[model samples]
Target: MTDCLFCRIVAGELPATVVLDTEHLFAFRDISPQAPTHVIIVPKAHYANAVELAQAAPALTGELIAAAGDVAKQDGIDSYRLVFNTGADAGQTVFHAHLHVIGGKPLGPSGLDLH
Candidate 1:
């Protein structure tokens, strides 16, 4: 999807404060972070949403979760929140599938509240 924002980021067409990158995943700082160390880990392959890809590709799913853990460790947060806003009701702004790893404080009810 050429119009996808995350695809652009994965392709390096858009500038992002990247935290980590692997053959299958790209982890970068969220432009509108919800925590002090907020990273969005996305797969290189485009998926519409979490539910759509959760079981379709096991390897990709494992890689995504691993990347989130790696990012949390790198951010030096003992604990972090991993979130996947599946649909519009969950507040997913972008259609691309991504895992939000946010920490660096006692995460509140709303995820992290970077503010």
Candidate 2:
């Protein structure tokens, strides 16, 4: 957990364009943004992935999701994508629980392809 990127960010050891900060969650702009407004939300406590976070801290899990909605609303996004990649095959580069709030333009039918 000490080496986790999100954890380091939460600890203020890294620099990120902060969007929102709550008691238990942190939201920041993604460095390599997939959309015009791409934000990554993560809990202050570390977890390997969504499933792990959900299983370990259900309340925090809810908070994480609610934070996503708050982020979208703050960004004035009517429609957006909430992405939670679970593994390497699913495009999860970081082994930490996080949610991606991606929106800014029409995402097309698939919506998965953010670019």
**The best candidate in terms of lDDT:** 2
lDDT of 2: 0.88
Regions of candidate 1 where Cα sits further than 4 Å from its true position: 111-115
Residue 28, model 1: lDDT of 92
Candidate 1, residue 83: how far the Cα is off, in Å: 0.2
Candidate 2 stretches greater than 4 Å from native: 111-115
Cα-based lDDT for every prediction? 0.85, 0.88
Clashing pairs in model 1, backbone N/Cα/C closer than 3 A: 34-114
What would the per-residue lDDT of candidate 2 be over residues 30-63, giving only the tens digit for each residue? 9888778899999888889999999999999999
lDDT of 1 by residue, 1-89 (tens): 89999999999999999999888889899998877988999888899888777877877898899888888888888798888888777
TM-score against truth, every candidate: 0.92, 0.92
